[model samples]
Target: MRFGHTFGRWVLDSLLPPRCMLCGEMVDEPGRLCAACWQGLDFIAEPLCPCCGTPFAMPVPAGMLCAACLAKPPRYRRARAALVYGRGGRDLVLRFKRADRTDMAAGLAALMRQAAGPLLHEADLILPVPLHPRRLWRRRFNQSALLAQALGRQAAKPVLLDGLERLRPTPSLGGLNRGERRRALAGAIRVAPGRRALLVGRAVLLVDDVFTTGATAHACIRALLGAGAASVDVLTLTRVVRPDIV
Candidate 1:
């Protein structure tokens, strides 16, 4: 079986050489970036907030939370993201979400899997931040669900695609304050009726495309906890980091 699979792959590769996902430069594997594009990615690393995983400007003591986190904590116990939503990251996300690049799910999920760090190990199940039926109908797909499914496959974890539901459709949240975002999203998310019982005592890992403000993720996490989830962590494709440029 292995030999046949290898031979098939060899034939396919010979017919169509792999190229970089970003620049289209030849590479050894599909759904991967060449050296330049890979290095261009700002992967989150150490010296970050233990709670939210926001990269610190400089080295800090262990277990130190960022100022924003310390003043008003997020609902998720911990969070991590693959890239700072800078030029490169933003381009990747836009192409994936808006340009019919669902094929990038595996590549982007691989990136998130790397940044997941210890979060994946502690999580009992993976859930995507769902879209409202209206939005789902318009968009035709939930990018977050795609990421969650791909990441679950790579991590060998069970993905509950319908674990949560968006109760209503929200307008564009741009230019809204944190408080405003919270209000807009209040009562807009809940654990799926069918999954509520199964979530009890489980540690959930919520997946999303981007983390701009904690409002959306917080609402989802709160619902998970309210449904009896023991804990909730978050993993995102990219995040809006501070100007400090960690």
Candidate 2:
């Protein structure tokens, strides 16, 4: 069986050689970045706020919170992401999110799994931030759902697909401040009625492709909490380093 599988893979590779996801350079596997692209990624690490995962300019004692979190704490218990949303990270995420590169989910989710060890381990269920039906129809898929599904598989947890619903469409959040974004998203998302009982007392790990501001995560988390979720944590593929951009 192993030999047959190996031979089949060899044939497949010969016919359709793998290429890097970013630069299209020949590579050993699909959904992989070339060395240059890999090195360009600023994968987020320590010296960050324990609450929001925003990196500190320099090392600080453990348990310190960023100013934003300390002043106006977010609704979620915590948030973590794999990459800083710089030029390289933005390109990769746009391809996966807007260029119909669904195949990249697993690879990206592997990174999220590594970065979000504590969040995944503590989550009782995984839920993706939902897209409105109109947007979902236009895009043909929810990028966040794809990431959540991939994460669920990697973490060996149940993924609650469609457990959350976007109640209304909102305008572009770009250039909005946190307060503006929050107001725009108020009452825009909710936990599906049928999932309320299931959510009760369960620790939810909310998944998203990117974290710009806390608006989207906050909306989903507030809904989940209102529906009786014990708590919600956020895991994202990337996030804006300057979350104030939105």
Candidate 3:
């Protein structure tokens, strides 16, 4: 069996020589970034806000909350992201989400799994922030759902794709301020009918592609809690980190 597996890998590699996922440069293995691309990614580490996982510029005491988080805490108990949404990360996410690069889901999900850490272990159920049926039809797939499915498999957790529903389509949140984002997503999400039972007394891990102002996460958390979920945490592939938060 071992010999056959090794031979199979050799055949596959010979046919499709291992290359970087970001750049086409040949690498030791497939589904990996080249050293240059890997170095360009800003993976979030410790010394961040405990509530929102916003990385701080300077060293601070552990468990300290950022001013924004302290002033107005997010609905979710905690949030974590794998990468800072900057040049390299942003391009990668955009390609995965907008360019029909579903093949990138596994690689992105691996990063999320590392970032999720204890959140996955503690979550009783995993779910994605839903897209409205109209948008889903247009896109032919929910990017978040793809990430959630991949992460669920890695974590050995049950994924509930239909656990939440988007009640209505909202305008683009791209240019909206924090308050405006909150208003735009208000009442836009809810637990699916007859699906609340799955959430009752469970801790949920909400998955998404990116965390901007967190308007979407807030809405999803409200719906999950209203459905009797004991608690909810958020995990995303990337997030916008503020520079002034030092």
Candidate 4:
């Protein structure tokens, strides 16, 4: 029975062979990442910034905060990120964004699950920061919603895509400092009517693909809190941290 099952599995694999999304290398697994590519992926490990959860050289102890946090703390109660947005990390995100490689969303969400782990148990709903209707029409999909749905499946929570609405299309936050980013994103997001009760007095987990300046997430958190959310936690697949610029 075991050998028969193994042979059947091999036949199925041969019919639908797995391949790495980044390198196109044939893989032995179902997902897009291969063993070598997975090993090369740089994950954010320890000694991270408490405010935005970016991996740093030195640890910022509990209750203590990083310079970024001291200068301008984000609205969310806490944030966690899986990897730094550099090298293959940036490539992965851009590929998913511009190149239309929607398959990468699953791989990225898996990475977030690993980062979030048991923290999934702490949230009542998984909310994806919505995109403006104009942008959504152009892209035909919301990356954050894809991430939230993927995470919700693993976390066993209802991924709420319409929990918040983007009222306007905020300018790209590229090359902006914390203050500028915050101002640019302000008034861009709000809790949707009727849906506000879903988060009232509940712990909400905001999901996004990347944490750059955290402008978008902060805006979303502020709106959710205003709608009576007891607390908000954030999770992103990756974070952009350029030391030379920061």
lDDT, residue 110, model 3: 93
Q: Candidate 2: list runs displaced more than 4 Å.
A: 1-15, 243-246
Candidate 1 lDDT: 0.88
lDDT tens digits, residue span 5-116, model 2: 6577667755897878888898887767889899989999888789899988888888988888888888899999999998778988999878776778888999899889
The weakest ten consecutive residues by lDDT in model 2 span 237-246
Please give the CA lDDT of all the candidate structures: 0.88, 0.89, 0.89, 0.80
Off by over 4 Å in 4: 1-15, 59-64, 70-72, 242-246
**Which runs in model 1 stand beyond 4 Å of their true positions?**
1-15, 243-246
Model 3, span 155-239: residue lDDT tens: 8999999999999998999999989999999999999999999999999999999999999999999999999999999999999
Clashes by residue pair, model 1? none
TM-score of each: 0.90, 0.91, 0.91, 0.86
Clash count for each candidate, listed in order shown:
0, 0, 0, 0
In candidate 1, where is summed lDDT lowest over 10 consecutive residues? 1-10
List the candidate 3 regions with Cα displacement exceeding 4 Å.
1-15, 244-246
Q: Write the per-residue lDDT of candidate 4 for residues 55-136, one digit (tens) a residue.
A: 6666555556667767877788778888778777777777777766655666778889888844578898999989999998
